[model samples]
Target: MSEQFERLSRLPLRDDLRGKHPYGAPQLDVPILLNVNENTYGVPDDVRQAIVEAVSREVVGLNRYPDREFTELRTNLARYLGHGLTPENLWAANGSNEVLQHLLQAFGGPGRSAIGFPPTYSMYPLLASSTGTRYIAGRGNEKFDLNAEDAAREVRQSGANLVFLCSPNNPSGSALGLDVVEAVYEASEDAQAIVIVDEAYAEFAHSGTVSALSLLAGRERLVVSRTMSKAFAMAGTRLGYLASAPEVADALRLVRLPYHLSAITQAAANAALTHSDLLLANVENIKVQRDRIVAGLLQLGLTPVPSDANFVLFGGLDDPHRIWQGLLDGGVLIRDVGIPGHLRVTAGTETETTVFLETLGALLERAVS
Candidate 1:
């Protein structure tokens, strides 16, 4: 712990929060950053101009709090997501992280339990903890893919109040099939659990991969969360939202702070959505790079998990951290998820992807020698 955090920790803290670390990916300064699955290809100039213009229009409104309901913003998001959703079916916050926090605040609390399949998003358990919700660590197969039967069984057994399923799951980049979603929903019926399908990377999934959104028609207990951060390249904006029944969105209103979204945030995200096509233009390029990384790793004799998201998780490393540091020394940074002997790297531009692959190949060559 840092000296500042140590001093802070000395003060009385929540008993459960004591000794717990914050969720973070290493924010390193390097020539190539593949650590977080960020769209290295930034906002296009035209879209940036639109966002600036949109925020300018909101400047006078800075005197007033933003729309507590975020009406127009939700409409834009609903239209973007399609599947015949409307503002009534939507709720958004600073990021998917906050959106999730809101869900926990509303439906998850002391005595209730939540569960997630790992190597998944780290925030699920953290969100549960912060809400005083008991968190259960669920499992997946060796490849990190949770089949329908296995996933449903865990839900039936855990009897959790909230369950998170990350489609095109983080770190491993494997997506959940709709069959799994349906099965888990059926199994959770007896327990009356809320099944949350986190689609943070949904936009980057390969074509023909059906989204959990398709399964949301009559499933009142189901929520499909999405974000502008990943494929939309708006990490700086921190806008995340979800689609569910109107009742679910109504429940969030009880817990969300009034006017939580600033005028500027609403403006920026609304502007980005205005040019959704332009903003999402790079998704194809990123997918190309993601596949390139997988192929490159396979050729290097490493085992890469087949990915549908914009990053690849690979294994077969003798010393994952050693290779991680070596890559950083070469000015490339990737993620060493706590999974032993495995590392994850975001797919960047063609050149950045080439640098990462070439760097890893050189490191492997050195290890052999």
Candidate 2:
């Protein structure tokens, strides 16, 4: 008989991701990059100094493991979140990405299902599949609005164990209103499923948008995942925290490896918290830039989605890929969302935005001619 290993090797991998890269658009070495939605600013000098100071004191044993519980970091995070954080109610991961994975490990797996709304973050389904969970998508309304009723119906019918919602949703830059989010939360409550509001872009949204934390009061099953990647400008540091009820937080901790965060990373994140004022200042700048860019796009005859986040999405170009390439060749790089004729551009510095607009103008002129 043929070797049993031969059959195992031939078996197909997960069907959900027949052919897909885990992430979109590899980072290229280009000037004026407005892709990936990173904060266009760098960590403030004061914050950098704090990082240097935190690690400057040499410990007795360099080989000793970091605090597995990350008590100090958790405390700082709790303080940062203002109301929802407690030592018992929060956890940190290598990144929000890892936090999401841990969630999948805990609540998702073979035979269980997770629901996401698309044209949202691409990672949700990918994470679900990697953990052997079935992934279901509820298409958004024509204007990319969250159809919470439809999503709730899907969850009820599919018995999904988790529901992921991204506020100021990725790619589209449209935020779900409070009523809609609350409706979904209420719907998921009976299913005993978790509702995760990924607030990666929350800091940039204008005030009064519904933060998941607002609804978290007394709600044990809701989780809000946040990252230092955007407003804090700490993406490379890979520090993210989740706010939830102590029990849910404990569940996440159980699934994560001990000491998942590095001493240096924890130090960096701690420093980031202290200088949040500086970060908020940058956020204000980005908001102004975002508005200016949106106005410019509208004036150019492109229809930009109303955005409360740090980026904007626009359509009406004949071929978005060609326009993206043209902008790239012109030394301005923006993301070509796979959605037909749409592109997402992150807010950058005034100078970079100026160059981007000029380049985009020339490209549109060429296309029109």
Candidate 3:
């Protein structure tokens, strides 16, 4: 082999992910997929038409590179947010995942640390590790509620430069209290650390909880990340956004790739924003289905976490893997949360939910016998 090839083979990658794949969950061909928390509904016809129109209008511009700054999309997004957001306070990326990665690169690095609340999103720790920052987890309370006091103490102790919180948290579907989030924000102030609230499911929880954006009046270090992937039925489109103070937005821009978002994606996202009301209606339907599922699980002697998101988590099954496999064999796929004895099931259409519950009933009866 050539000397260059030999040198490449000799270099070892970072120890944090020596032999790891970044993404979780394997892809499977199934009739009904309730595993990944995707909105079961398809995009509305009006939104689809708008996207077509947007793409048609932008076709002429394809010969040249897209707007590196994504000016129009940023301005439109800021206006849509309607809570003190301006173009200067907005940033867009391939997805919220990418926005998160930019934040890590901007605020986390060698000799620095970031804090995460466990049984939350799995990506936070992975992102922190990838950026060469120390990742620490503070366990959530009994109800899966974030312990703000403990979080603040740990951040102060570790001198962490970033803290990540996910409302309507993944796998558990519990929304963190606004007061707790604000407390953590205040505690991180002295350390000059950034507080990121991932509001990926905010639309689903719109009826009750206050968004982190609503609490961003004087907080310069707080950043709120949202995605169109959840309630908007556009996970395949890959559009995510961040709302923050202008200074923090500037920091994210500095670390993100130039032209990180494509013109096509920007157009699709803008189109989707215009049809948010229609999307919310779909969310309402999913919420109804979620409630039904939760009640059904309880009847089967399972305890489900109270959820505001479009998914539910339940306990009582001894081996979740067996239940997961049984559901798959019955043509319904649900998520096997890493937490032993617990499983997460995303809300599908009314009919799909019915099929899932019927299948699960049969499986549980067999297990009991």
Candidate 4:
């Protein structure tokens, strides 16, 4: 048990959560923040103005509740995704984390189990635990690469009722090909699993990286979840949604709180989607920095995993903590991610990237000579 468990011993805390810690990264007040994989660029002027106007309009109607279904927001999100997706095929929540939570509540419970590959999103297991679902830690092949056959085999072995596939997966920064998704779905036939493709970082994927949305045509068991937090430059919006069979939305309705999405949130998200073109312009710049970080790491004699997301995970640090502390002391903050000799850094603005690379290079030089 954790030290906190003793402090809360008098209360009726859940036994499963005895020693658990909440999921979070440092929110330090530093000059440069390349951790947390957030879009470092602030919202564009036009988009910011649009969100302001939309939210202002909702203030007058604060006395009334938000749309129970968030209909307009769903329509806008559907239009933004555009893989023949309609509002009826969409669902929304406070964030993608909650979207996953709702799915767990609707489909996962005491008798159900959920599975995901390791070194993937940390939230998958946490979300599973929150909903009383068993979390199965699956595996990846060499260098954290998972192929169709290997993934399918694991799913069959786990017999999980729900499966989370984090595309352009977190920390590793690689996406799963559609074949893997297809094979996993096929393998899950006997278990009747609900396969979720977490495309939270899809907008940042490299050239020709396919998305699971293309495979959702007739698959009632597949869901493609997305968020406005990454390339959209709307992390403050806290909006996450999914495209699935219409019946899935109906299932969620039974468990979600009334007016879970507020009027202000719907307005702001709808406005942001209308200006998605301007918002996505920032994604191109971030991708440039991502590539640059990979190349810079190579020049520094470090190994940067190939990435389709806005961050890079690099290895070869002699003492990971020393380097992490060195960077922090230099006024730049990145993620250690608890991996030995490996750390993850989000691709920030050009200036931020340059400083990070330069700062890290200096530290490496000092460590050697």
Candidate 5:
């Protein structure tokens, strides 16, 4: 297997992809899994039972194709989002990544470019590359924050046909202000670009952090994408959706394959939506633990970025990879997100959080001694 995989890489591949690595986080089996920003709490028993019932109902209908447009699932998603949206204003796929790929396919291609403000979600650039779109690197400040002015400047300068902004950004966890979203949308007017706000982590954001969905009222060029993978505790279900103008949703239809969503997937997500409140009950608890992580990292004299998501990114490490390995050796798994001198850990359950903090504290103490 290893020899064949190595040979495959050496085969004639896309020149741009020749030396590039695939996107992945270490999937180690550990006592405490604080990587990947998954909800530590599993699906509630009530929601699980409801989903099972929903899926069972669709079993006999397996011979038929899922709704080509997934009407019922879209309506349920619209109801969950609650911005006076209808199925016309929604689109969904196996994951937000696919939803995003649809957008790029419709608006971006050879000779057109897309821009993403980094240390953002790594997939934005990868998506651009895979779709035969030029990837333009946009800048964020030293603290990895992108203000309205800088964002507007990058959009205008890059002449980007698509722009991606990840709020409660991964590896940083800071939420982008709505003002930034508005500014970037306005800036992209000349380029006729589509702006995508990847809010996969929005449910875990601190209160008062507004979603870009609020800005979709008049902005036909704006898209706010979300997923069930994070706070919804439905990562394995793989349902992601986006909200935009009805016209934008129509554009996505031209690019998406027919019957892209499986009947089982639609049933599972719809049933989960019916029990939305119960599924989201753990959000506040996760927020509490996220705050605890920030405070605990501070007490250890590390520089932890203030986060609006379930994970915390911290710096001031002499060797981030070494510390990551040390934590893994202690049976706690976290992410070393290629950021020099920094590491990120998800806000796990209380006991898991305790194990992570205790293990790291001991390591820090040992280093100091």
Candidate 6:
């Protein structure tokens, strides 16, 4: 623990939160950063111009609080999601993390427990703990594949109040099949549990991969979360939203602070949605780079998980931290996801991808020699 942490720990703290490190990826000033799975392609010029104009319109209106209901924002998000969703079925927050926190605040807390499969998004546990929800560490197969039967069995057995299924899961880059979502939801029926499919990276999924959004109809307990951070290239925008039954939105309203989303945030997100096609054009480029990274890793004798998301996770490193540090030393950065013999890297531009693969290949060759 750092001196600051030691002092902070001295003060009274929640038992679950003590000795915890916050959810953060390294925020270093590296030339190429693939560490955080960001959409490094950035916003297209057309969408950028639109967002600037929209935000400018909101500047004078900043004197007033943002639309407390975030009405127009929800309308845009609902239309963008396009499974016949309406504003009543949508909710938004600063980020997917906050959107998740809202869910936990509403459905999870105190004696209720939440569960997530391992090798998944790190924030699930943090969100659970912060909300006073007991966190259950669920499991997946040795290869990190989470099958439907296995997933449903655990949900059924745990009787967890909130089940977080991180499809195209973070740090692994593998997506859960729709069958898995269906099975888990069915398993939760008797328990009346809330099944949350965190689809932050949904837009990056490979062709023909169906989203949990398709399963939302009549499944009042099901929630599908998405973010503009990835495909929309709006990480700085901090806009994440969910599609669910209207009742879920009502539950969140009880917990979300009034005027939570600022007017500028609402306007910018609406502009991005208006030009969703332009912003999403770069997704194909990212998918290409992601596949390229996977191929390069395999050629270098590393085992990369086949990905549906905008990043790739790989194993076969004898010392992952050493490899991570070596990459950083070479002015590149990727994630050391704390899995033994594994690390994750976002799909950057073609040029950045080339540099990362080259740097890593050289490091391995040198280590062997």
TM-score of each: 0.98, 0.93, 0.94, 0.98, 0.97, 0.98
Supply candidate 3's per-residue lDDT for 209. 84
Which consecutive 10 residues in model 2 have the weakest lDDT in total? 1-10
168-225: candidate 5 lDDT, tens digit per residue:
8887999999999999999999999999999999999887888888899989999999
Prediction 3 global C-alpha lDDT: 0.86
Q: What C-alpha lDDT values do all the predictions have?
A: 0.93, 0.83, 0.86, 0.92, 0.91, 0.92
TM-score of candidate 3 versus the correct structure, residues matched by position: 0.94
* Candidate 1 Cα RMSD (Å): 1.1
- State the displacement of the C-alpha of residue 215, model 5, in Å, after optimal TM-score superposition: 0.7
RMSD of each: 1.1, 3.7, 3.3, 1.1, 1.3, 1.0
Residue 13 Cα positional deviation in candidate 1, in Å, after optimal superposition: 0.9
| Alpha carbon deviation, residue 296, candidate 5 (Å) | 0.4
Q: Write the residue-wise lDDT of candidate 2 on 141-237 in tens digits.
A: 5578777687667666756789898888898888887677677777877678988988988998877776778888788888989999999988888
User: Model 6 clash pairs?
Assistant: none
lDDT of 4 by residue, 184-295 (tens): 9999999999999999999999999999999999999999999999988888889999999999999999889999998988998999899999989989999999999999
**Which residue ranges in model 5 land beyond 4 Å of their true spot?**
1-6
Q: What is the lDDT of residue 104 in candidate 3?
A: 91
lDDT of 5 at 316: 92
Root-mean-square deviation of candidate 3: 3.3
**Over the stretch 109-224, how does candidate 6's per-residue lDDT look in tens digits?**
99999999997888899889999999999876457799999999999999999999988888788888999999999999888999999999998899999999999999999999
Give one clash count per candidate, in the order shown: 2, 0, 0, 1, 0, 0
List the pairs of residues colliding in candidate 1.
94-238, 168-175
Q: 186 in model 3: Cα distance from truth in Å?
A: 1.7
lDDT of 4 at 160: 97
